[model samples]
Target: MALAAFMLLLLPVLQGCAIQVTFDGASIPENVNTASVQLFENRAAYVNPVLSQTFTEGLKDRIINGSRLTLADGTGDVDFSGEITGYDTEPLAIQADAVSTETRLTVRINVRYENFKDPEKSWESSFSAYRDFPSEQNITAIEGELVDEIVEELTENIFNKAFADW
Candidate 1:
C-alpha cells in the first residue's frame, strides 16, 4: 500500500505529453508580434488596380487576425512585398475554333518575404490561379467574374504560404 501511494504521487510528473505542432521550421514561437504587408504593385496592362489592394489587404488580415501577429508599416519581424506580374486569358480548349467555347483567366504573382529576425532565411515564391469562362473576345460579365475569381484564389494561396505554412 505504501509503494502504491508513492507511484500515484509521481504519476503527474512522470507522464509524457503529446504536443500538436503546426510549424514546419524553426518552431516559430507564438505571438510573433509584428508584421507588415505592402500594397502589391502591377504595371501590367488590362489588370485591375483594386485587385492588387485586395490581395495585399487579405494577406495582412490573415496574418494579423488569424495568426495573432501584429502589423508594422516600415520594419518588423516579417515584411511582405510583391507585384502582379501577369494577367491574361486564353482559350484552354477549342472546338473547331467556332467562337471558342471555353476560355481561361490566369493571374500570376511574385511574392517576397523577409524575416529580419533571421537574416539568413527568407522566402520568395510565385503562385498563380486560373479559371475557365465562356469564350468571348471582348470583356464580358463572365470574363470579369472569372478574373476576379482567379485573383481571389491567388490571394488565398499567398496568405496560406505566408501564415498557414502551406
Candidate 2:
C-alpha cells in the first residue's frame, strides 16, 4: 500500500515529462507557421466549369482543418500552386455485349509545393483521384457528386504529402 501510494504520487511528475503529440499527426516544421494556397487553374481539355474553384477551396479547407498553420495571402512560409492537368472519363467494366457497364471519371492535378524555410524540402508532383459510376447514368446528373468525392480524396492526398511525414 505504501509503494502504491508512492507510485500514484509519481504519476503526475511522469505526466509532466511525457512527450506531447498532436492529434492531427501533421509533421510540419516548427518554423512553418503560415501557408498559402493559390487558385488551381483548370488546364484540362475537358473542363468542368467549377472544378478549379472547388479544388482550390477544398485544398484550403484541408490545410485549415488539418494543421496548425495559418492561411496567408500570397506566399507564406509554405506555398502551394497547381493546375488541373487532366479531367477525363473512360469506359470501364465492359459487358459481354461490348458495352461499358461503368465509366471512370478521373481528375489529375500537378502540384508545386514551396517550402521557403527549407527549399530542399519542397517538391512538385501530380495527384489524381477517380470514381466509377454506372454508365447508364448521365454524367451531368452525377458529375457534381463524383467531383466532390474526387476532390476530397485529392485534397487529403495533398495534405498528407505536405504535412505528414509518411
Candidate 3:
C-alpha cells in the first residue's frame, strides 16, 4: 500500500517531464508570435468575383483562431501569401449512358509560408480541395455554397501545413 501511494504521488511529477502537446495539434515555434496573411489573388482561368477575398479572410481567421499568433498589417514573424491557381470542374460517376451523374468542382491554391524566425522551416506548396454535386444542378445556382465549403477545407489544409507541422 505504501509503494502504491508513492507511485501515485510521483505520477504527476513524471508527467511534467513529458513533451508538451497542444489540443489543436499546432506546434508553432515559440518565437513566432505574429503573422500576416496577404490577400490571395484569383489567377485561375475561371475567376469567381469574391473568391479572392473570401479565401484570404478564411485563411487569416484560421491562423488567428488556431494559434497564439497576432495579425499584422504587413509582414510578421510568419508571413503567408498565395494565389488561387486553379478553379475547374470535371465529370465524375459516369452513368450507363456514358453521361456524368456527378460533377466535381475543384479549387487549388498555391501557398508561400515564410517563418522569419526560422527561414529553413518556410515552404511554398499547393493545396486543393473538391466537392461533388449532382449533374442536374446548375453550377451557377450552387457556386456560392460550393465555394464556401471548399474554402473552409483549403484553409484547414493551409493552417495545418503552416502551424500544425502536418
Candidate 4:
C-alpha cells in the first residue's frame, strides 16, 4: 500500500513535465521538417570523380536517418550546397632512415547552409577529414576505402553543425 501511494505521487510530478529525446540529440526547430542537398562539385586539385556524388548522397542519408527531416526535391526548410575544396596527400611519420612510414590523405569541403525559417541561424563553413595509410602501400589500392571513411566523418561533422547546434 505504501509503495503504491508513493508511485501515485511520483506519477503526478512526472506527468507534469514534458520530456523528449532523439538518437542524435538534435535540437532542430519544430517548424523545420525538410532539407535539401545540392550536388557537391569536385573542384579539388586532385579530383575524385565520384566524390561529389558520394558526399551529396552521404549527407542526404545522414539527414534522413539522423534527424526528422525529409529530403526535399529542390529547397526545403533548410538547404545545403557545397564543393570539394581540397584533396591532398602528405608524408607523415618520417623515420631515422629518412623514409616516410605513412601517407595522410585529407579531404576538405566548403559548405553553405541556409535555414529559411530563421535566416540568422544560417551559416557557411568548411569541414575536412583524413585517413593515413602505410607509405609502402599504393594509394590506388586504398583510395576508395580511405575516401569512404573520410567522407563518413565529414558527413557526421557537417550534420552535427547543422542540426545539433554544435
Candidate 5:
C-alpha cells in the first residue's frame, strides 16, 4: 500500500535522527572524569559555627550525586574552592508603628570553579540566597532551619552554574 511504503521510508529517517538526553543535565566534557570540592570556610562577620562544615559537605554531595565525576582529595579535572563571604539579617516590611513585621536572613558565598579540560569555561562568582521570618521570631531559635534551607538553595545554584552549562 502507498501509506505502508511511506511509513517505512520515514522510519529510517527518524531512526537516524535519534536524540540523546541526560536526566541530570550535566554537560561535562568526555575527558573530565574527576572533581574536587575544598572545604568552604566561613569568613562572615557573625559566623555560624557549623556553616563551614555544612556548606562544604552539601556542595560535595551535590556534585557526587548529580554528576559522574569521581571525588578526589587533590585537585581534579574540575575543582571547586570557596568561602562563605556574608551572613546577615536585616529588617523588612516595616509597619506604620516603626516596627519590623518581618526579617530576612541572607547568606552569600564566593565560588571558584576550574575546568582543566576547558579552561575557557572556568569562572569565579558570588551566589546568595535568603529566607524571611516574622520579626518576632528569635534568630537563635530559627537560624538552624533558615541556614539549612538557604544552603540547599545556594548549593543547587552553584552546581547548576558549574555543570549544567546553562
Candidate 6:
C-alpha cells in the first residue's frame, strides 16, 4: 500500500520523465495491410500437449485481442508464422554426493514476420527458455508446470518483441 501511495504521489512527476525500456527493436512499418499468425506446431514428443496448446493458442489470442492488425484471411498485408522447433529436457548439473539433483528444459521457437505489401525483408527470430530444478529421479508434472511458466513468459516476450515496439 505504501508503494502504491508513493507511486500515486509521484505519478505527476514521473510523467515528465521519459520511461526508458529495453526490448528487441523490430521495425513495424506504418500502413500495414493485415497481419496473420499461423497456428504454431509442436514437434517435440516429450513436450506436454497442454503446454503446447496453451502457449500457442494463448499467443494467437493475445495478438488478435491486443493489436490493431487484422488477420490475413488470404489477403492480409503482413504475415506471421511460428513453430516449435525444439523441446528437450536433460540433466544439467548434479550435487549432494554425486546424486543427480538438477535438470533443465529447453524450448526453442522460430518466428517469421514479413511484409507482404512491400518488398520489405522479413524478420526471423528464434528464442528459447531454460529452467533448472532439483531432479526427482523421475520426470513429473513439476517439469510441465515449469515449461508452462516458460511458455507464458516467452509468449508474452515474443508478443512484445513482435509488435509492442518495446
TM-score of every candidate relative to the true structure: 0.72, 0.87, 0.86, 0.87, 0.85, 0.66
Candidate with best lDDT: 2
Q: Please provide, for model 6 over 77-154, each residue's C-alpha lDDT reduced to its tens digit, 9 standing for 90 to 100.
A: 766677887888877666667766788888888887676756455578987887777787455757667777788777
Candidate 1: the clashing residue pairs are: none
Count backbone overlaps in model 2: 0
The lDDT values for all models are 0.70, 0.92, 0.90, 0.91, 0.89, 0.69
TM-score attained by model 1: 0.72
Candidate 6 or 1, higher lDDT: 1
Give me the displacement of residue 107 in model 3, in angstroms. Answer: 0.3
What digit string (tens of lDDT, one per residue) describes model 4 on residues 1-166? 9999999989888655533235777777767889999999999999988889999999999889998789999899999998999999999999999999999999999999999999999999999899999999999998999998998999999999988789
User: Candidate 2: where is the Cα deviation over 4 Å?
Assistant: 1-21
lDDT (0-100) at residue 47 of candidate 5?
93
Off by over 4 Å in 4: 1-21
Candidate 5 clashes between residue pairs 3 or more apart in a chain or in different chains: none
Native-referenced Cα lDDT, model 6 = 0.69
Please provide, for model 2 over 68-126, each residue's C-alpha lDDT reduced to its tens digit, 9 standing for 90 to 100. Answer: 88999878999999999999999999889999999999999999999999899899999
Alpha-carbon deviation at 121 in model 6, angstroms: 5.1
lDDT of model 5, residue 58: 89
The regions of model 5 sitting more than 4 angstroms off are 1-21
- Sort by lDDT, top down from the best: 2, 4, 3, 5, 1, 6
Error of 4 at 124 (Å): 0.6
What are the runs in model 1 whose C-alpha is more than 4 Å off?
Answer: 1-28, 136-144, 164-166
Q: What is the C-alpha RMSD of each candidate to the true structure, in Å?
A: 6.1, 3.9, 3.4, 3.5, 4.3, 7.7
Candidates 2 and 3, the one with greater lDDT: 2
Please write out the lDDT profile of model 3 over residues 109-166, one tens digit for every residue: 9999999999998999999999999999999999999999999999999888877778
